[model samples]
Target: MLIRRAKQEDYCVFAAIEADCPGYPSWGANGFAAEETNRNSVTLAAEFEGAVAGFVNFWILRPQVQLNSLAVRGDMRRRGTAAALLGKTLEYARKNACTAVDLEVSELNSPAIAFYLKQGFEVVGKRPKFYNNTETALLMRKTL
Candidate 1:
Protein backbone atom coordinates (compact mmCIF):
# COMPACT_ATOMS: atom_id res chain seq x y z
CA MET A 1 0.00 0.00 0.00
CA LEU A 2 1.17 3.52 -0.74
CA ILE A 3 0.65 5.74 2.26
CA ARG A 4 0.65 9.43 1.36
CA ARG A 5 -0.79 12.78 2.30
CA ALA A 6 -4.53 12.88 1.85
CA LYS A 7 -6.00 14.92 -0.96
CA GLN A 8 -9.35 16.68 -1.12
CA GLU A 9 -10.58 13.97 -3.50
CA ASP A 10 -9.84 11.24 -1.00
CA TYR A 11 -12.37 12.44 1.55
CA CYS A 12 -15.38 10.82 -0.09
CA VAL A 13 -13.80 7.42 -0.18
CA PHE A 14 -12.39 7.91 3.28
CA ALA A 15 -15.86 8.71 4.50
CA ALA A 16 -17.07 5.48 2.96
CA ILE A 17 -14.36 3.54 4.74
CA GLU A 18 -15.45 5.16 7.97
CA ALA A 19 -19.02 4.18 7.28
CA ASP A 20 -18.03 0.59 6.68
CA CYS A 21 -16.76 0.37 10.21
CA PRO A 22 -20.05 0.64 12.04
CA GLY A 23 -20.03 2.15 15.52
CA TYR A 24 -16.76 3.96 14.75
CA PRO A 25 -16.93 7.74 14.98
CA SER A 26 -17.06 9.27 11.54
CA TRP A 27 -16.03 12.67 10.33
CA GLY A 28 -17.55 12.97 6.90
CA ALA A 29 -16.18 14.86 3.92
CA ASN A 30 -17.13 18.21 5.37
CA GLY A 31 -15.30 17.47 8.57
CA PHE A 32 -12.18 16.49 6.65
CA ALA A 33 -12.49 19.63 4.60
CA ALA A 34 -12.49 21.59 7.82
CA GLU A 35 -9.19 20.02 8.73
CA GLU A 36 -7.53 21.79 5.84
CA THR A 37 -7.83 24.99 7.83
CA ASN A 38 -5.90 23.57 10.77
CA ARG A 39 -2.18 24.05 10.24
CA ASN A 40 -1.17 21.45 12.78
CA SER A 41 -3.38 18.70 11.33
CA VAL A 42 -1.95 16.05 9.07
CA THR A 43 -4.16 13.64 7.16
CA LEU A 44 -2.93 10.60 5.28
CA ALA A 45 -4.38 8.03 2.93
CA ALA A 46 -3.44 4.39 2.26
CA GLU A 47 -3.82 3.51 -1.39
CA PHE A 48 -3.92 -0.05 -2.68
CA GLU A 49 -4.64 -0.99 -6.26
CA GLY A 50 -5.29 2.63 -7.10
CA ALA A 51 -8.02 2.95 -4.49
CA VAL A 52 -8.05 4.51 -1.06
CA ALA A 53 -8.06 1.60 1.36
CA GLY A 54 -7.61 3.50 4.58
CA PHE A 55 -6.80 6.86 6.13
CA VAL A 56 -5.43 8.42 9.29
CA ASN A 57 -5.50 11.96 10.67
CA PHE A 58 -3.45 13.40 13.48
CA TRP A 59 -2.35 16.63 15.06
CA ILE A 60 1.33 17.40 15.68
CA LEU A 61 1.70 19.14 19.01
CA ARG A 62 5.47 19.61 19.30
CA PRO A 63 6.50 16.76 21.60
CA GLN A 64 3.40 14.74 20.92
CA VAL A 65 1.13 13.60 18.10
CA GLN A 66 -2.52 13.17 18.85
CA LEU A 67 -4.05 10.52 16.62
CA ASN A 68 -7.49 11.86 15.86
CA SER A 69 -9.01 9.30 13.51
CA LEU A 70 -8.26 6.18 11.50
CA ALA A 71 -10.22 3.67 9.44
CA VAL A 72 -9.78 1.00 6.78
CA ARG A 73 -12.07 -0.17 4.01
CA GLY A 74 -14.18 -3.11 5.13
CA ASP A 75 -12.99 -5.34 2.31
CA MET A 76 -9.40 -4.32 2.97
CA ARG A 77 -9.10 -5.25 6.60
CA ARG A 78 -6.11 -7.37 7.70
CA ARG A 79 -4.25 -6.25 4.61
CA GLY A 80 -1.87 -3.90 6.44
CA THR A 81 -3.74 -0.76 5.39
CA ALA A 82 -4.18 0.50 8.94
CA ALA A 83 -0.66 -0.50 9.88
CA ALA A 84 0.84 1.24 6.89
CA LEU A 85 -1.12 4.40 7.62
CA LEU A 86 0.04 4.27 11.25
CA GLY A 87 3.65 3.54 10.28
CA LYS A 88 3.67 6.61 8.07
CA THR A 89 2.08 8.67 10.82
CA LEU A 90 4.93 7.62 13.12
CA GLU A 91 7.46 8.68 10.52
CA TYR A 92 5.78 12.07 10.34
CA ALA A 93 5.89 12.33 14.13
CA ARG A 94 9.58 11.43 14.19
CA LYS A 95 10.41 13.91 11.45
CA ASN A 96 8.60 16.64 13.36
CA ALA A 97 10.52 15.94 16.61
CA CYS A 98 7.60 14.35 18.33
CA THR A 99 8.39 12.15 21.32
CA ALA A 100 5.16 10.21 21.51
CA VAL A 101 1.82 9.35 19.85
CA ASP A 102 -1.46 9.48 21.73
CA LEU A 103 -5.07 8.51 20.99
CA GLU A 104 -8.34 7.52 22.56
CA VAL A 105 -10.31 4.45 21.44
CA SER A 106 -13.75 3.32 22.40
CA GLU A 107 -13.45 0.90 25.28
CA LEU A 108 -15.67 -1.62 23.52
CA ASN A 109 -13.46 -1.71 20.43
CA SER A 110 -11.40 -4.77 21.29
CA PRO A 111 -9.89 -5.02 17.82
CA ALA A 112 -8.57 -1.47 18.00
CA ILE A 113 -7.27 -2.03 21.50
CA ALA A 114 -5.35 -5.05 20.29
CA PHE A 115 -4.08 -3.17 17.25
CA TYR A 116 -2.80 -0.33 19.45
CA LEU A 117 -1.18 -2.82 21.82
CA LYS A 118 0.51 -4.52 18.88
CA GLN A 119 1.80 -1.14 17.82
CA GLY A 120 3.48 -0.70 21.26
CA PHE A 121 0.83 1.54 22.83
CA GLU A 122 -0.18 1.23 26.47
CA VAL A 123 -3.38 2.18 28.24
CA VAL A 124 -2.65 5.50 29.95
CA GLY A 125 -6.06 6.57 31.22
CA LYS A 126 -9.76 6.69 30.50
CA ARG A 127 -12.64 9.08 30.03
CA PRO A 128 -15.93 7.78 31.24
CA LYS A 129 -18.67 7.93 28.60
CA PHE A 130 -16.56 9.93 26.25
CA TYR A 131 -18.09 8.30 23.19
CA ASN A 132 -21.55 9.70 22.57
CA ASN A 133 -21.68 9.98 26.33
CA THR A 134 -22.46 6.27 26.36
CA GLU A 135 -19.24 4.35 25.77
CA THR A 136 -16.04 4.81 27.71
CA ALA A 137 -12.91 5.92 25.96
CA LEU A 138 -9.57 4.27 26.63
CA LEU A 139 -6.66 6.64 26.33
CA MET A 140 -3.58 4.98 24.88
CA ARG A 141 -0.12 6.28 24.19
CA LYS A 142 3.11 5.12 22.56
CA THR A 143 6.41 6.76 23.30
CA LEU A 144 8.61 7.30 20.30
Candidate 2:
Protein backbone atom coordinates (compact mmCIF):
# COMPACT_ATOMS: atom_id res chain seq x y z
CA MET A 1 0.00 0.00 0.00
CA LEU A 2 1.14 3.51 -0.80
CA ILE A 3 0.29 6.00 1.91
CA ARG A 4 0.47 9.64 0.96
CA ARG A 5 -1.17 13.01 1.46
CA ALA A 6 -4.73 12.95 0.24
CA LYS A 7 -5.54 15.15 -2.73
CA GLN A 8 -8.81 16.67 -3.84
CA GLU A 9 -9.53 13.76 -6.16
CA ASP A 10 -9.40 11.30 -3.29
CA TYR A 11 -12.08 12.98 -1.18
CA CYS A 12 -14.97 11.29 -2.93
CA VAL A 13 -13.31 7.90 -2.54
CA PHE A 14 -12.87 8.55 1.14
CA ALA A 15 -16.47 9.59 1.41
CA ALA A 16 -17.52 6.41 -0.35
CA ILE A 17 -15.46 4.34 2.05
CA GLU A 18 -17.19 6.11 4.93
CA ALA A 19 -20.53 5.40 3.37
CA ASP A 20 -19.72 1.70 3.27
CA CYS A 21 -18.77 1.70 6.92
CA PRO A 22 -22.03 1.50 8.81
CA GLY A 23 -22.25 3.67 11.93
CA TYR A 24 -19.26 5.73 10.92
CA PRO A 25 -19.62 9.48 11.50
CA SER A 26 -18.97 10.57 7.95
CA TRP A 27 -17.48 13.84 6.92
CA GLY A 28 -18.71 14.06 3.32
CA ALA A 29 -16.48 14.77 0.37
CA ASN A 30 -16.99 18.49 0.83
CA GLY A 31 -15.96 18.20 4.44
CA PHE A 32 -12.77 16.41 3.41
CA ALA A 33 -12.08 19.07 0.82
CA ALA A 34 -12.51 21.79 3.43
CA GLU A 35 -9.65 20.35 5.47
CA GLU A 36 -7.25 21.90 2.99
CA THR A 37 -7.96 25.23 4.66
CA ASN A 38 -7.21 23.94 8.16
CA ARG A 39 -3.53 24.34 8.95
CA ASN A 40 -3.60 21.77 11.71
CA SER A 41 -5.27 18.98 9.78
CA VAL A 42 -3.52 16.24 7.85
CA THR A 43 -5.43 13.92 5.60
CA LEU A 44 -3.85 10.88 4.01
CA ALA A 45 -4.92 8.35 1.43
CA ALA A 46 -3.85 4.73 1.12
CA GLU A 47 -3.51 3.55 -2.42
CA PHE A 48 -3.47 -0.18 -3.04
CA GLU A 49 -2.99 -1.70 -6.47
CA GLY A 50 -3.45 1.75 -8.00
CA ALA A 51 -6.83 2.21 -6.32
CA VAL A 52 -7.72 4.21 -3.25
CA ALA A 53 -8.45 1.74 -0.49
CA GLY A 54 -8.52 3.79 2.69
CA PHE A 55 -7.91 7.13 4.33
CA VAL A 56 -7.01 8.73 7.63
CA ASN A 57 -7.51 12.26 8.94
CA PHE A 58 -5.82 13.71 11.98
CA TRP A 59 -4.81 16.93 13.65
CA ILE A 60 -1.35 17.85 14.85
CA LEU A 61 -1.70 19.66 18.17
CA ARG A 62 2.02 19.79 19.19
CA PRO A 63 1.86 17.90 22.47
CA GLN A 64 -0.84 15.66 21.09
CA VAL A 65 -2.20 14.23 17.86
CA GLN A 66 -5.93 13.76 17.57
CA LEU A 67 -7.05 11.11 15.10
CA ASN A 68 -10.27 12.40 13.61
CA SER A 69 -11.18 9.59 11.25
CA LEU A 70 -9.97 6.39 9.61
CA ALA A 71 -11.59 3.86 7.31
CA VAL A 72 -10.57 1.11 4.90
CA ARG A 73 -12.53 -0.58 2.18
CA GLY A 74 -14.14 -3.86 3.24
CA ASP A 75 -11.82 -5.81 0.95
CA MET A 76 -8.83 -3.93 2.24
CA ARG A 77 -9.38 -4.63 5.91
CA ARG A 78 -6.70 -6.75 7.61
CA ARG A 79 -4.42 -6.22 4.64
CA GLY A 80 -2.29 -3.66 6.46
CA THR A 81 -3.79 -0.73 4.56
CA ALA A 82 -5.43 0.63 7.69
CA ALA A 83 -2.35 -0.11 9.73
CA ALA A 84 -0.14 1.61 7.19
CA LEU A 85 -2.32 4.71 7.29
CA LEU A 86 -2.24 4.71 11.08
CA GLY A 87 1.48 4.05 11.11
CA LYS A 88 1.99 7.13 8.99
CA THR A 89 -0.10 9.15 11.42
CA LEU A 90 2.04 7.95 14.31
CA GLU A 91 5.16 8.77 12.37
CA TYR A 92 3.87 12.33 11.91
CA ALA A 93 3.05 12.60 15.59
CA ARG A 94 6.57 11.58 16.56
CA LYS A 95 8.08 13.92 14.03
CA ASN A 96 6.05 16.82 15.45
CA ALA A 97 7.18 16.01 19.01
CA CYS A 98 3.71 14.93 19.94
CA THR A 99 3.63 12.86 23.09
CA ALA A 100 0.45 10.96 22.46
CA VAL A 101 -2.28 10.06 19.99
CA ASP A 102 -5.90 10.36 20.98
CA LEU A 103 -9.19 9.42 19.41
CA GLU A 104 -12.77 8.58 20.23
CA VAL A 105 -14.58 5.64 18.68
CA SER A 106 -18.17 4.62 18.95
CA GLU A 107 -18.60 2.18 21.83
CA LEU A 108 -20.58 -0.01 19.49
CA ASN A 109 -17.62 -0.39 17.15
CA SER A 110 -15.92 -3.29 18.84
CA PRO A 111 -13.69 -4.07 15.88
CA ALA A 112 -12.19 -0.60 16.03
CA ILE A 113 -11.74 -0.85 19.78
CA ALA A 114 -9.92 -4.12 19.28
CA PHE A 115 -7.77 -2.65 16.54
CA TYR A 116 -6.75 0.26 18.74
CA LEU A 117 -6.03 -2.04 21.65
CA LYS A 118 -3.78 -4.03 19.37
CA GLN A 119 -2.08 -0.83 18.37
CA GLY A 120 -1.20 -0.20 22.05
CA PHE A 121 -3.99 2.25 22.84
CA GLU A 122 -5.88 2.09 26.11
CA VAL A 123 -9.34 3.28 26.88
CA VAL A 124 -9.06 6.28 29.16
CA GLY A 125 -12.52 7.78 29.29
CA LYS A 126 -16.00 7.82 27.85
CA ARG A 127 -18.59 10.32 26.71
CA PRO A 128 -22.18 9.21 26.95
CA LYS A 129 -24.35 9.71 23.90
CA PHE A 130 -21.42 11.05 22.00
CA TYR A 131 -22.49 9.47 18.72
CA ASN A 132 -25.60 11.06 17.28
CA ASN A 133 -26.69 11.45 20.86
CA THR A 134 -27.28 7.70 20.98
CA GLU A 135 -24.17 5.55 21.30
CA THR A 136 -21.45 6.21 23.84
CA ALA A 137 -17.99 7.14 22.67
CA LEU A 138 -14.93 5.45 24.07
CA LEU A 139 -11.96 7.76 24.35
CA MET A 140 -8.68 5.96 23.76
CA ARG A 141 -5.10 7.14 23.84
CA LYS A 142 -1.58 5.91 23.13
CA THR A 143 1.23 7.68 24.88
CA LEU A 144 4.43 7.81 22.89
Candidate 3:
Protein backbone atom coordinates (compact mmCIF):
# COMPACT_ATOMS: atom_id res chain seq x y z
CA MET A 1 0.00 0.00 0.00
CA LEU A 2 1.15 3.54 -0.75
CA ILE A 3 0.24 6.35 1.59
CA ARG A 4 0.22 9.91 0.23
CA ARG A 5 -1.47 13.26 0.57
CA ALA A 6 -5.16 13.13 -0.32
CA LYS A 7 -6.34 14.61 -3.60
CA GLN A 8 -9.53 16.39 -4.59
CA GLU A 9 -10.68 13.32 -6.51
CA ASP A 10 -10.26 11.22 -3.40
CA TYR A 11 -13.05 13.03 -1.52
CA CYS A 12 -15.83 11.19 -3.39
CA VAL A 13 -14.14 7.89 -2.68
CA PHE A 14 -13.63 8.85 0.95
CA ALA A 15 -17.25 9.87 1.21
CA ALA A 16 -18.27 6.52 -0.18
CA ILE A 17 -16.09 4.73 2.33
CA GLU A 18 -17.57 6.80 5.14
CA ALA A 19 -21.08 6.04 3.92
CA ASP A 20 -20.36 2.34 4.05
CA CYS A 21 -19.43 2.61 7.72
CA PRO A 22 -22.94 2.77 9.10
CA GLY A 23 -22.34 3.83 12.69
CA TYR A 24 -19.27 5.92 12.05
CA PRO A 25 -19.36 9.68 11.79
CA SER A 26 -19.00 10.96 8.23
CA TRP A 27 -17.55 14.21 6.90
CA GLY A 28 -18.81 13.75 3.33
CA ALA A 29 -17.15 15.27 0.27
CA ASN A 30 -17.99 18.83 1.27
CA GLY A 31 -16.30 18.49 4.64
CA PHE A 32 -13.18 16.97 3.14
CA ALA A 33 -13.09 19.75 0.59
CA ALA A 34 -13.29 22.35 3.33
CA GLU A 35 -10.18 20.93 4.93
CA GLU A 36 -8.24 22.06 1.90
CA THR A 37 -8.54 25.57 3.25
CA ASN A 38 -7.37 24.69 6.75
CA ARG A 39 -3.65 25.36 6.87
CA ASN A 40 -3.02 23.04 9.78
CA SER A 41 -4.97 20.08 8.49
CA VAL A 42 -3.32 17.16 6.72
CA THR A 43 -5.35 14.60 4.84
CA LEU A 44 -3.83 11.42 3.55
CA ALA A 45 -4.92 8.51 1.44
CA ALA A 46 -3.83 4.89 1.48
CA GLU A 47 -3.78 3.51 -2.03
CA PHE A 48 -3.75 -0.15 -2.92
CA GLU A 49 -3.71 -1.45 -6.45
CA GLY A 50 -4.41 2.06 -7.77
CA ALA A 51 -7.54 2.40 -5.65
CA VAL A 52 -8.09 4.36 -2.47
CA ALA A 53 -8.15 1.79 0.32
CA GLY A 54 -8.08 4.06 3.38
CA PHE A 55 -7.60 7.60 4.61
CA VAL A 56 -6.57 9.56 7.70
CA ASN A 57 -6.91 13.24 8.55
CA PHE A 58 -5.15 15.09 11.34
CA TRP A 59 -4.07 18.52 12.50
CA ILE A 60 -0.50 19.33 13.46
CA LEU A 61 -0.59 21.64 16.42
CA ARG A 62 3.09 21.79 17.34
CA PRO A 63 3.18 20.00 20.69
CA GLN A 64 0.26 17.82 19.76
CA VAL A 65 -1.54 16.30 16.81
CA GLN A 66 -5.29 15.84 16.77
CA LEU A 67 -6.36 12.77 14.84
CA ASN A 68 -9.57 13.94 13.21
CA SER A 69 -10.71 10.95 11.17
CA LEU A 70 -9.64 7.54 9.94
CA ALA A 71 -11.35 4.87 7.89
CA VAL A 72 -10.50 1.94 5.69
CA ARG A 73 -12.54 0.37 2.92
CA GLY A 74 -14.52 -2.57 4.31
CA ASP A 75 -12.82 -5.02 2.02
CA MET A 76 -9.42 -3.57 3.00
CA ARG A 77 -9.78 -4.13 6.71
CA ARG A 78 -7.40 -6.58 8.44
CA ARG A 79 -4.94 -6.09 5.62
CA GLY A 80 -2.86 -3.36 7.39
CA THR A 81 -4.29 -0.45 5.42
CA ALA A 82 -5.37 1.34 8.58
CA ALA A 83 -2.06 0.67 10.22
CA ALA A 84 -0.15 1.96 7.21
CA LEU A 85 -2.26 5.11 7.13
CA LEU A 86 -1.75 5.62 10.85
CA GLY A 87 1.95 5.02 10.50
CA LYS A 88 2.09 7.78 7.88
CA THR A 89 0.17 10.09 10.18
CA LEU A 90 2.72 9.48 12.89
CA GLU A 91 5.51 10.16 10.46
CA TYR A 92 3.94 13.52 9.65
CA ALA A 93 3.44 14.25 13.36
CA ARG A 94 7.07 13.54 14.18
CA LYS A 95 8.25 15.58 11.23
CA ASN A 96 6.23 18.50 12.47
CA ALA A 97 7.75 18.25 15.97
CA CYS A 98 4.57 17.00 17.57
CA THR A 99 5.04 15.43 20.97
CA ALA A 100 1.78 13.51 21.21
CA VAL A 101 -1.21 12.35 19.21
CA ASP A 102 -4.78 12.43 20.51
CA LEU A 103 -8.16 11.23 19.27
CA GLU A 104 -11.62 10.26 20.45
CA VAL A 105 -13.16 6.90 19.64
CA SER A 106 -16.69 5.76 20.29
CA GLU A 107 -16.82 3.55 23.37
CA LEU A 108 -18.93 1.06 21.50
CA ASN A 109 -16.14 0.53 18.99
CA SER A 110 -14.23 -2.14 20.79
CA PRO A 111 -12.29 -3.15 17.71
CA ALA A 112 -11.00 0.38 17.17
CA ILE A 113 -10.18 0.77 20.84
CA ALA A 114 -8.19 -2.45 20.73
CA PHE A 115 -6.49 -1.33 17.55
CA TYR A 116 -5.49 1.99 19.12
CA LEU A 117 -4.20 0.16 22.18
CA LYS A 118 -2.15 -2.14 20.00
CA GLN A 119 -0.82 0.96 18.26
CA GLY A 120 0.50 2.18 21.67
CA PHE A 121 -2.25 4.60 22.69
CA GLU A 122 -3.66 4.76 26.22
CA VAL A 123 -7.00 5.94 27.47
CA VAL A 124 -6.59 9.47 28.83
CA GLY A 125 -10.17 10.35 29.60
CA LYS A 126 -13.81 10.03 28.53
CA ARG A 127 -16.76 12.16 27.55
CA PRO A 128 -20.19 10.90 28.44
CA LYS A 129 -22.62 10.86 25.50
CA PHE A 130 -20.00 12.26 23.20
CA TYR A 131 -21.34 10.58 20.11
CA ASN A 132 -24.79 11.53 18.85
CA ASN A 133 -25.50 12.37 22.49
CA THR A 134 -25.94 8.62 22.98
CA GLU A 135 -22.69 6.68 22.79
CA THR A 136 -19.80 7.74 25.00
CA ALA A 137 -16.35 8.60 23.68
CA LEU A 138 -13.02 7.40 25.02
CA LEU A 139 -10.17 9.83 24.64
CA MET A 140 -6.92 8.15 23.77
CA ARG A 141 -3.41 9.51 23.40
CA LYS A 142 0.03 8.41 22.33
CA THR A 143 3.13 10.35 23.28
CA LEU A 144 5.75 10.46 20.59
TM per prediction: 0.98, 0.98, 0.98
Residue by residue across 1-144, what tens digits does model 2's lDDT show? 899999999999999999999989999999999999999999999998899999999999989999999999998898888789999999999999999999999989989998999999999999999988999999999999
Report the Cα lDDT for candidate 1: 0.93
Query: What local lDDT score does residue 136 receive in model 1, on the 0 to 100 scale?
Result: 96
Please give, for residues 54-125, the per-residue lDDT of candidate 1 as tens digits: 899999998999999988888888877888999999999999999999999999999899999999999999
Better of 1 and 3 by TM-score: 3
Over 1-144, each residue of candidate 3 has an lDDT whose tens digit, in order, gives: 999999999999999999999799999999999999999999999999999998999999989999999999999999888899899999999999999999999999988998999999999999999999999999999999
Runs with alpha carbons beyond 4 Å of true place in candidate 2:
none
Ranking by lDDT: 3, 2, 1
lDDT score, candidate 3, position 37: 98
